[model samples]
Target: MTEISTLIVDGILAVLLVSVIVVCTIVYRRLGTIKSGQAELRALVDQLNTAVVDAQRSVANLKTSATEIEGRLQIEGKKASAIADELGLITEAGNNLADRIERGLSGATAAKKQQAPAETSASKKQQEEILAALREAR
Candidate 1:
């Protein structure tokens, strides 16, 4: 009977040892899975960081281009203003010349009308011919 009791105790110890080994194997497998996922998570974080850095550089480049464009626009605006002022002066000079020509023609017609009655017959005939020629030219 004592020998039988010793065998039963040994069997129980063997069962406990087997259970411990099975639990250890399950824990080791779970840890290996976690390690694999950790590597993938690290790679994803690195990719996100690289994308952020690239975006920052693009923003800086855009800012530089905008500043350059603004400077060019200001320069063009100044040039356009100067051209407009020059055109205004040219227009004023043309108007003044046209007025002078109009006044000169009117004065010449008035002088001719005042002298027509005092002219001799031959001179009056010559003046008429000249007037006719002026009309045709006009």
Candidate 2:
């Protein structure tokens, strides 16, 4: 009976040892897979960091370019204002010249009505000159 008990105990111990070996093998394989996943995660984080840095540089350059364009637009705005002022002065002078020409023609017609036969060769030359001036102005 004692030998039979010892045999049963030994068989149980062998079975326990085999179970422990199998559990250890499974744990080792899982640990290997976790290590490979960790390495891939680290590589992905490095690439994301690099892309963030590049984006920051691009934003900085774009800001500088926008500032330069704004400065150019301001300069152009000043030049346009100056040109508008010059054009206003030119328009005013043209208006004054047109008024003078209109008044001169009206005065000449009134003088002709006031004195007809008294107008001499000199007066004829003057009328001719005025007509010539009017035509030239046109």
Candidate 3:
């Protein structure tokens, strides 16, 4: 009876050891899975950081380009304004010259109606003077 009891005790201990080894194996596999997942998470975080940095850099470059474009636009706008002003002055001068020419023609026509036909030399001289004035205005 004593020997049979000892054998039974040894058998129970062997079973318990086997169960403990199985539980340890399961825990180790789960730990390994968690470690792999953590490595993947770290890699994803690194990629995200790189993307953010690149985006920031791109935004800075865009801002610089916008500033340069804005400066160029302002310069072009000023040049356009100056050209418009010059054109306005030219137009105003042309209108004045046209008025002068119209008045001179009307005066010559009235003078021709008032003068005798023998005063043709005087009319020709007046026309020459008007032509010289027109040339000088140019």
Best by lDDT: 3
Off by over 4 Å in 1: 1-31, 109-138
Better of 1 and 3 by TM-score: 3
TM-score of 3: 0.61
Candidate 3 lDDT, tens digit per residue, 5-50? 9999999999999999999999999999999999999999999999
Return the candidate ranking by TM-score, descending.
2, 3, 1
How many residue-pair clashes does candidate 1 contain? 0
Per-prediction count of colliding residue pairs?
0, 0, 0
What is the TM-score of candidate 2?
A: 0.63
The weakest ten consecutive residues by lDDT in model 3 span 116-125
Model 2, total clashes = 0
Scored against the true structure, residue 20 in model 2 reaches a CA lDDT of 95
Question: TM-score of every model?
Answer: 0.56, 0.63, 0.61
Give the better candidate number (1 or 2) by lDDT: 2
